[model samples]
Target: MGKNFTYLLGMLITIIIGTILYFNLCSDCIAGSSNNEVEQVVTEQATAPEPEPTSYPFAIANGDFDYSAEDNFNFDLSSANLRLPVSEKVDFGIYKLKDYLAENAGKVINITGLYSSKEANNTAFPNLGLARANDVKNYLVKLGIPSSQTNTFGQLKDELLPLDGVLLGPVNFNLADKAEDESETIAALLEKIKTNPLIVYFETGEASINLSAEQRQKVADISQYLDKVDGAKCLVIGHTDNTGSRATNISLAKDRADFVKSYLVRNGILENTIESSSKGPDSPIATNDTEEGRALNRRVEVTLN
Candidate 1:
């Protein structure tokens, strides 16, 4: 009986050991399979494709030109066109503008035609603004930029805060669509001449004003004012020094005054408003004996009344 009980206990111990070994082996196999799966996932992730970098089409938009912004990125044509006194036909700096536009052809552009109320307090201000905008648009169109790509705004009244005025007072420019439209007021016209006087000087024995490229601007400035100011009376007074014969001086002075008047009328100034007069050797601001004085005296003054 004792031997039978011991044998039975041994058999039970062996069976327990076998069961424990079988469970441990199955656990190890499961663990190894899980590790292999984890390594495969890591390898796949390491060989995965990466996203590409970003790109821009306007890398060469500014071209080879350099530009400075006084306020923001709005390119100023004022330096080339608006700051100077303008005539019916004046030098509008269009060439440099064209170069810039051509370089940025694919991009859209905005042109703000800036005007001042103090300088251009006439009904013609709006027209002037529109014309300037149109000028830029037309130029860009000619340079292969589509007309639809350009947006133009003409502001007759400066909306800038803190009064950012340039070159003193206002700048006026106009492009009239109709012939009979009277747009500028007398007060505005008088103010224009008072702020910016138009004085044409004459060479000795010459009655005609110089029409050179530089002088053309001066003439245009006066003519533009006259054109805008309808029925605006002007005293076109010519003066000469006591150098030549009194009668000859008088004739020269009269001729000079008349020539200026004719030029004004030809450039859109009304004929009846301009009163041509000569003050030969009479109104001497300086001594007529000196060449400097003579040069000063040999001048045609246009005063708006």
Candidate 2:
């Protein structure tokens, strides 16, 4: 029995030692494995690729025209000129836009040109934004889109990021509502024109005129009206202050009216359709006793007949 007990005890001690050694070796192995895992994680993190730069896409869309995920045009800082990107997709998209507009009648395009106040305005337009939009409109017109079907204006944008000194897709295209009945449209246009007639104010002895975007649009609308309504006439009436003699004032007023007529004729309106006259100092919309009133008096009133 004692010998049996001694053998059993020796087996117990051997089993204990083996357990201890195994645990110690396993701990070391576990530690080594953990260290290797950490190293692998670090290596992977270091070898990972950097994220790509952000891309600004240029696109155009309308009712029938699908939005194309392609760059069409780019512009330099403070520039109104269009810089075409090196992509055939642009041409395809433009042709598609043109086709869509041609197929869809009575629909008009409104082009909004975005500009930053930080940019310089060097164009003859009222602002860089309008000039940019007008350039785009002109391009579309050259592409066979009717000038009457496209209208342009400017919008101020505070957030315009330029990539390498170039602005991508600075213009936006929106389709205006389809025209209603022809007579209804004409009546509405006439009401608007008469209620808010384009009154171009002039300085003393100044012949050059600069029109605002709204005024320019009015001129376009008038041109469109004259094109549609046969025998319609555009009357340009000039008024003056009572500063000079009646005859001299009438002559000055006549010259102003003639200048306005020329301007209208230059903008697609037929010269023969326009009639110019001078009211001299007889028709003053304001008091001629003050400078401000006199300034208001030196004006040309455009009306549709």
Candidate 3:
């Protein structure tokens, strides 16, 4: 009986060990299969293709509208009047142009002066075209429009039309982006001052203020600028037409400079910040032979520093 019991106990122990071994092996195999499945999922995810990115349209600087010169009116070159638009009733063209520019301050204006004839008897075409364009630019600047918003082009007639006189093409107005670079900004500012010069004209041989609306506007612009920029200085340079002797013109130029300086001071500009000088007829911008050219030559330039 003892022998039989010992044999049965040994077999039972062997069976228990076998059952444990089988369970352990099955668990390892199942774990390995699960690991393989996880790796396959990770590999698939790593090799999957990414979605494409969306693209957008490029933006335009001056908005989407197409702007051109067709929006503005042209001036009549037949009239000899060069004064700023007022009660003169000279022509509605300038007034219309001014109104359009005023309403559309964001738009850039291009004033092109066109001459019908290039005869020597006619006013120097270059000077005439320049003067007319300058006049329009000055008027706009006086009305508080920025000088950078305007440009001038002069076109003398290449071919004369029958009975056609000096005619100004329609002032071109278009949408333009603001100047981006420092150089462009400086250039625009310089052009602004040059086009709208503060010319304190005098009597034939005197140093009195011309007392015109144009002069008043210059004074106002200068005063406004001075007020806006503290510690700013201006150099008031006087000039003369070549109508008199050199010594006489130099003296007249000085007198004119003094008057301009006094005028600025009177208008609340700092006296110390203003410097005055004279160029006389030595720096005449226009020809001395013609009355109109001489008129243009006699002027004052206010340079801001």
Per-structure clash totals for the candidates: 2, 0, 0
Q: After superposition, how far is residue 54 of candidate 1 from its true place, in Å?
A: 39
lDDT of 1 by residue, 51-94 (tens): 43221111111345433222211112242133323221112233
TM-scores of all candidate predictions against the true structure: 0.36, 0.52, 0.36
Give model 1's TM-score versus the native structure: 0.36
Q: Rank the candidates by lDDT, best first.
A: 2, 3, 1
Worst 10 residues of 3 by lDDT: 52-61
- Candidate 3 residues lying further than 4 Å off, grouped into runs, are 1-191
Candidate 2's residue-wise lDDT over 1-305, tens digit each?
99999999999999999999999999999999999999999999999986442234546555456666557566788998877643577666666767777877677777788888999865545567767776676667667776656667789885887877888777777777555676688788888888888889999768787787788667756755664566788889999999979999999999999998887654435577799999999999999999999999999999898
Q: Which has the greatest lDDT? A: 2
Would you list the C-alpha lDDT of every candidate in the order shown?
0.53, 0.77, 0.56
For 39-118, candidate 3 gives per-residue lDDT tens digits of: 99999999998643221111112354432221122334543224333322313334444565566756565655444454
Q: Return the lDDT, model 2, position 267.
A: 41
